[model samples]
Target: MKRLPPLPALHTFLVTAQCCNFTRAAEQLHITQGAVSRQIAGLEDHLGYELFIRLARGLELTAEGREWLPKIQQVFDLIGDSVEQIGAKRETLQLKAPSCVMRWLLPRLMQWQRERPDAPVKLTASLQHGVDFQREQFDAAVIYGTAPHDLPAALHMFDEQLTPVCSPMLLKGAPGLNAPADLQQHLLLHPTHDDQDWALWLKAADLRLSNIGSGQHFETLDQAMSMASHGTGVAIGDWSLIGDDLNAGRLVTPFDLKVKTGLGYYVVAPDRPEPSAKLRELMVWLVEQAHTR
Candidate 1:
């Protein structure tokens, strides 16, 4: 390894320069601003170059700092990743998650971060219908379904059923939505899929409407949820996702009707002789955290 400066100061310098604010970096590092300032000053003395240009407003990286920032930051992140890998713990785990589960998992992931601070988590979403895990370069993926998935590396996680959700404002504004037939008057969000999820829900509810026409189409559940939150239309979202929204009062399910999706969340990975350690740890964590409903 190349000779390196003291880690604490190096970390302080990198974080501060990235934020362009000593105080903000200190807050993020959970250290005193004075300590952050001292570290940067020490790093400058060791390197014999000022890394920042201090202004009355805040700070800006010097030319030298700008050149060095990316390299040093990548090194710092790699160090963290290395520790986990060497320990047989985990380094970075790239995950392909359904947009719905992403919202639910992200908030709860803070607890996991606290436990394994060194683990790098790379989360991305999939909108491609019936994803090909290997082709996508994901270590593991969480998708909605229980069918005979073609990938042998996949493991079943959780089954989530569907529910109707709309902004509370919509429900409160229009009392006529108490019956399923009243959906004719409201906009409904639709996703492009081989399976029409909302249509199945309507059938389960035994309601007939003149219009099965799509009101607004979204490529991802997250976008659909956002639109519904803005009171644009009703969203037939899975509770595993929209549950938090429903609980937080952003949305409400005025009707009790819900349906079992033929699809649920599945955890998958690339088939190989041996998978990376980080991927394995993440797969276990994902299975343990699977939501039941």
Candidate 2:
């Protein structure tokens, strides 16, 4: 902290130096000229140097001021860069999608961080997260919905399919679950996710249930998946989201049935211009990293 100046005073001094007139600088800064003068004076006293010489016409940069201008500009430039970096570090990578997508994306970010190291990835759970991407200061968005539809300049990163997931303990205990009717004996964990996921999975297997799904409903896929992980119940999980857990032996699908949803993960940027290198790197890495899943 000792290496830094009083921010307000430094701001005043910079503006005054730019205009070379306290009055104009005050107007630009919406402060009184006297305040500007006092700030510059305080800065000079702190440095044991005079930065300006007053004249009836206006103000002139002293020899010291002339020497300091470039250094001061460099300091201000450094400050600006530091602030941008901080903003980027904590920025919200708003995602307009289901909570399950958030769960999936965040865990995999470690791969990207291993490369960029400084990239900050934030996630939001909403279907409309990308609508105000610019105004909300979002660097990029990962949307979950049917694709081959119109998207922003961003790329379609990955395609997702559905697979059944259940707690290992539950599946072992429930037994007879090789077919859909046996599911009636157990709780069906659902968050009212994508339409027909359960129905399609059953349809593919030529099975139906009068009450195949009768259990407490969750509000988010993350919640449902968590319960499934704990052997609480069975759920229809998007492969893209639960694929890692399945591979890691944390969860498993006892059945081989699979079906594709109309939905997939899309990495959308604005329609206007090329996304910044940072956003581009983030977007590309996300797609490439998850495509195999």
Candidate 3:
């Protein structure tokens, strides 16, 4: 059998490549920037080729590095999945959720941990809105959209209610946002490239703006909401997901109106004749939390 490169060096290379900066990678890895540099250098020497082209500002992956990245990620993912499926880790409930719901889901998970320290939950956040239980290892998932018909159990959490949210500073600014029409005077942050969320809200409000697609756009609702909280622009946010932000005054609703998109978030589990008592208990607790929120 052939010898493999040091696992620590490979892990360091992976983190450095993902961050594109030795300093940031060092911060994430809890090591000195010099140590990160050394690991990358060692990995490059072992591979007999340079993986990254270090620039003054940051690093850029060489062709070889780019090609090797996904393969390395898969290797690590498989290793992680294998470890979690065996022994004591297997008893922990694995949950997957879209990143859009972090504002709501994270706090609840923390509360759940406090209440039931014995029943641990391993959460994996992803960009994907839906999950395929057969292919994924999660015991349950928080899905956004219409209820999934194929799942054995799908517990409705809340409806998708869209409303404009921004920093409280926007409320005091000129051309005050007294009504939906006042949006024309301010920037509109779109959570998607297609600007569908903003469009949906506008259509529901029976209002239209010529520059609907004109402001900053983000890849996720969370990013748009973050910018909105900073007073960058007004974002069409899911009302349920931004409760914490609203409570903390980091964001505020500009209008009282909320438009229901006929979509919602649900806690779904795969088809199983009899789920574990712990899984059932977690799902019930999640639904109760959702209702209370």
Top candidate (TM-score): 3
Clash totals in order: 2, 1, 0
- Top model number, lDDT: 3
Each model's C-alpha lDDT? 0.71, 0.69, 0.84
What's each prediction's TM-score? Answer: 0.61, 0.62, 0.72
lDDT of 3 by residue, 86-188 (tens): 4264468889998788878988998997898678888888878999977888889999988888886888899989999999999998878888888999999
Off by over 4 Å in 3: 1-90
**Candidate 1 at residue 116, lDDT?**
72
Superposed model 1: Cα runs more than 4 Å off: 1-90, 129-136, 148-150, 193-195, 276-278
- Cα deviation in Å at residue 102, candidate 3? 1.4
Model 2 per-residue lDDT tens digits across residues 1-293 = 33344455677777788889999998998756765776687578667889999999999999988887777788899977975776575643434444447667766775665676566555555635344555765556777666634545657766667777887777667455666567776677774634366777778778776655456455456656766776767787777678777887878887776788666778777765667777787877777867766
lDDT of 2: 0.69
Residue clash pairs of candidate 2: 97-126
- The global Cα lDDT (0 to 1) of model 1 is 0.71
**Clashing pairs for predicted structure model 1, backbone only:** 144-264, 145-264
Write model 1 residue lDDT over 1-293, tens digit each, in one string: 53356555677778887799989998998756765776687578768889999999999899999998998889988987975666465456667776567666675565676777677676676544346754677667776666545777776666667777888788778645777777888888764432377888888988766656646665556656766776878777877666567777877886887787767777777677466776677777767776432
